[model samples]
Every structure is written in structure tokens, then in C-alpha cells.
Target: MALGRNISPGQGAKYYRKDDYYIEKEGGEEHKLEWGGKLARDLGLQGKVDAETWEKALQGHFPGGVEIQGGSMVDPKTGERCHRAGTDFEFSAPKSVSIQALVFGDERLLQAHKEAAAEAMAFLEEQVGARRGHAGKTWETTGQALTAYSRSCWTPILPHDGQ
Candidate 1:
């Protein structure tokens, strides 16, 4: 299943910097970052998701004359303020699949899940947009979705194990 939530200003760092809930590996832990959507490439946001770049992206600070101050963007047309930021979409694997991957120690299974999630996110990016005016005008955007793999293993028992 997939879930999503809004990421407020200053909170964008949590997604890229923190790896508290991700899977652990030998020697150390690792998390991969990938930028999704057309705007991401246009903005030259490749490799990793950095805090400064993410902050600018969150504030709609584009190259075409958008101004950001006090964690908000000033609309160039009407002088209105826009405080909306990014959205976090979490794509999770089914419990049976997760347990199977963990128990069998199949990295390929995990990779497959990650790829599936990325594909789903790509589809979602096409549907995302930003509002333009008071008359319900909206335009398509890259959605600036950052994709990564996450696993939560802190619980004593896996919730879907039917304990």
C-alpha cells in the first residue's frame, strides 16, 4: 500500500538527512536518493537531496523570478504569499512480501519493491500540480518527489505477522 502526507517548511531535511527508519546493513546503514519528475531535472537537482536545494524547491523558488522570504514565496503576479511546501509519498510493501524478503535474505526482492515504488511514484508525478490563481487555475509540476527505500524494524513483532 501507498500513503502520503505534506512536508512543511524546514521539515524537508528530515526525509533526506534522517535514516532512522530504514533498513540496516553490514558495517553500516545506507539510503539512496533519487529525484523524480521533469522539473527536478530542469532544476539540475541530481545525485542527493541537499537541504538548501530542498528548501528552495519547497518554497517554489524557481529561476523564473520567484521570491522567497520568511519561509514563504511571494506571488509575482498578485503579491500574495504562498506557504505550501512538498508532499511525502510513502510506498510500502505488503507484510507477507516484507517478511519473505527478510526471512529469505533476498536483496533482489527488496530491490524489486524499490523499483516498483519508483514506477508508481513516476505515475503519481504526472498527476501532481500547483495551483496558480484564485479562479482554480493549476499547472503541472514535477512534484519534486524524492524516492528512497525505508524499512522499520524497531517493533518487537511485525504488525502484519498476526501475533
Candidate 2:
């Protein structure tokens, strides 16, 4: 018998029986069939077959067997493929630019900028000291402070016109 075959009432007038059969009533109309009865009936089985035979047939037809092959090709000599060669892809050394133009425009603003940076650095150092002996904690605290300052400075430099 199918699992969950105990006789019990379900939604509306649907009732399940011990043999996995069910009676369903809709708009005062009643219909009866075994579990998966419609499918079996459609397959031309007229009456209930033994559980073993049904199970064997079901297992035989079950859509469970599948095989997958990993067919990715790799070249042992030169790693992975590149879209372009040396001429199309050129690399240049990174250039360091002054932060003065970014944070200040004039002499007065330059002094203010220096003071702000010093204060931020001091605050970060204090946080690192507070996390003394905890290597991960100090690194995390410093990273958070640096990230906040970097984000604040970079936000204005990013293009937001189209977005």
C-alpha cells in the first residue's frame, strides 16, 4: 500500500482509506479512486495490483538515474586563455597622486585638511591601543576607520550623473 493510507478526512469531503484509496466530494458530487489511480488507469491497469508488483514497476519507470560528465578542457602549458595578446593589453606602473587637491583648494583649507587627517589618525591609533593584545580586534578596528574615511572621500569623486 502507499504511504499515509490511514482512513482520514481531508479538506472538503475528501477521505483517505487504508488501501491508499480516496473519496472526494465537490459541490455534493462524489468521486472515488486509488492513490495514483488515475495515472494507473490511464496506463490501462483496470484494477488494483499487488504492492510488490506496483512498486517494482514504479521503480523501473522512476526518473531517478542521471549521469553528468565534467568536460572542461585545460591546457597544461600556459594556464588559461586570454582574449587579447601583448599589444591589445598593456600594463603601466601605478602613479601616486597628492591628496591636497582632493581635500583642499587653498592654503587655509590645506591647514584644515591636515588637522582633520591628524585627528582621524590619532583616533584610529587610540582605538588600536584600546584593542591591545587582541591582534584581530586591532586590525578590524583600524580597517573600519580606514574604510569609513575612504568611502567619505571617494563618494564625491564618483560619477553620479547618469545613476
Candidate 3:
């Protein structure tokens, strides 16, 4: 009899077996990544979260941004495509000291970042759409939400002049 493992919907996030983990990425199929196992665990992924969770939250809820899927990267300077591997994980908190804000605590940072990034993206898309002759782009909400999101995330943690 051949040895096999039953597959589950969310198991695609991280398939584990025999004290080893089988991690499948978006383009992992193209890369022919059969099994990563201990060699990958040694690299420090720690299996905090899964891809499907993050993907469903971001794209399904509020789509668009840099399009970080399938392990592909775009060169900013020359606009070229590149292949990149690995997962980006971080634990975030509310970063606020308010009583009401304390309710959410630190668990909302990832969602906050993803949501803000999505709003910013949607704003840009709408503006571009308007320029291309599309209608229904509202500047009011875009100015508020998109700006707040950008300022909150990309705040200058440095001291310098615009010179």
C-alpha cells in the first residue's frame, strides 16, 4: 500500500507530516517544490500564519495594492519581473493607548496594515479610472482615508528637509 496524507482546504497553507512540513507557495507549483521539511523549518518561518488566511483577508475583503502573489516581484527602477520566495510575517498591535482602542489590542495591526494598503490602492485606482474616462470616483473619501492610512503607516521616522 502507498503511503498518503489526506488534504484539507486550509492545509494548503502549511501541510505537515512526519515531523516535517510541506509548505506550498503561490508559484511553488512552477518551482516544482515537492516538500520543504526540516531544511525550511531551519530557516525560521515558525508557521505563525497561513497564506490562505492572509490572502482571503486582504483580496477578498479589500483587493489590490502591490499585487504580492505567486512569489513574483517587480523591479521599481527598471520595471522588471523577478522571482522571490519565502513568507512575510509580523506581529502587530494597535499602537494606540486609548481605552476604546485597547479592546482590539495588538491583533489588529496586520489587518489594519492590509486594510489601509487596500484603501490607498483603491483610491489610486479610482483616480486612474477617472483620468481614463471612468466616472463615480469620489475625492472626498479618498482624501481622508487614503491620506490617513499613508500617514499612519509611512510616517517619517527621520528628521530631514524636503531640500
Candidate 4:
């Protein structure tokens, strides 16, 4: 039988029962033991195990440590594909681009990703261009655009009002 310790009332009491006594003292309180009606000998579970042995036994039940694999739950017989979504497809010239841009591990794809990210950052700059501020250290984009708005400045390099 899969027995467990009898926890005190309101102290993990739900996970315990008086009949299923598995371990010894827990959190400065020893499990409540009763006789006649129930005992370790009566349940035929008089075997003793140290904390180290019990811990080792517990590890045997879980594979790949503690984390449960999400994809492991899929039915191999039925499940075939997984899908991903995106807001807009970048790295190309298109009026109001709104499609998925899937990328894989390849030099060409990696270059495309860099270009796409730059294009996105440029679009963001157009919407909200850099402003004048004060800071010792500043950040800059790879290209001569999307510069951080820090230090003495005059006017904002605003972009034309267009989508």
C-alpha cells in the first residue's frame, strides 16, 4: 500500500491519514501513532528506512530530474505539427506587412533575422524618435539610426507622418 505520514490538523493534514504512516518525525513534530485500532505491525508495514534511503528511492520515480516534459503529453499517433504566430513579417519591403516570418538555423536565415530586427527598430524610431535627455553612458543601434536620447540636444529628428 502507498502509505504516508499522519500530519497534524491544518498542517498538511489533507495529504496524511492515521492509517498510512510512512515516514518518521517531520517539522519538529513526530507523526501521531495509535495502537490496537491501527499500528505499524497491524498494517504489515513495520519496515524502517532512513531519510537518505527514502530520498534515493523517491528519485527513482522521476525521470530527467523534477521537470515534467510538456511535449511528452502529446499523443505520438495523432499529433503531427506545432504552430507559431507573429505580428508582422520583416526583412522585406511590403506596404502594411502582416504575416508570419518563420526562421530556421541557417546563415541566410540569421542574416534575415538581423535585417528584420533592424527594420522593426527603424519603424519604432519613426513612431517615437529619440529625444534629448541626460546620461553619462548611452546606447546606439548597429546602423547610424535608433540612437539613445541622452546628453545636450536641440530638436527631434522626426520622421514623416506616414504608416
Give one digit per residue, the lDDT tens place, for model 2 in 7-85: 1111111112222333223322222322222223344443333333333332223223322111122222345432210
- Reference-based TM-score, model 3: 0.21
Most TM-score-accurate candidate: 1
Q: How would you order the candidates by TM-score, starting with the best?
A: 1, 3, 2, 4
Candidate 3: residue 58 Cα off by (Å): 28
Off by over 4 Å in 4: 1-105, 129-163
User: Cα lDDT for residue 56, model 2?
Assistant: 32
Expressed as tens digits, the lDDT of each residue in 1-163 for candidate 1 is 7787655554555434444323222234343444456666665655544445555666667545644332354543456665646556767777788888778777887878868876887788677655566677766564654343333321233234110
lDDT of 4 by residue, 1-163 (tens): 1122211212222122222342344442333321111111233322343233233222221222432111112222345332211011123323222122222324554455446555564554444322234474444322222111111111124443221
- Global Cα lDDT for candidate 4: 0.28
Cα deviation of 89, candidate 3, in Å: 24
Give the whole-model CA lDDT for all candidates, comma-separated: 0.54, 0.28, 0.31, 0.28
Q: List the residue pairs that clash in candidate 3.
A: 93-106
Q: Per-residue lDDT of 1-163 in model 3, one digit per residue for the tens?
A: 1122222223322222112222235434222112122322333323332344333422322233233222344533346664422222222324452223345554365456656545544454354211222385443321211111111232213443221
Best by lDDT: 1
| Residue-level lDDT for 126 in candidate 1 | 71
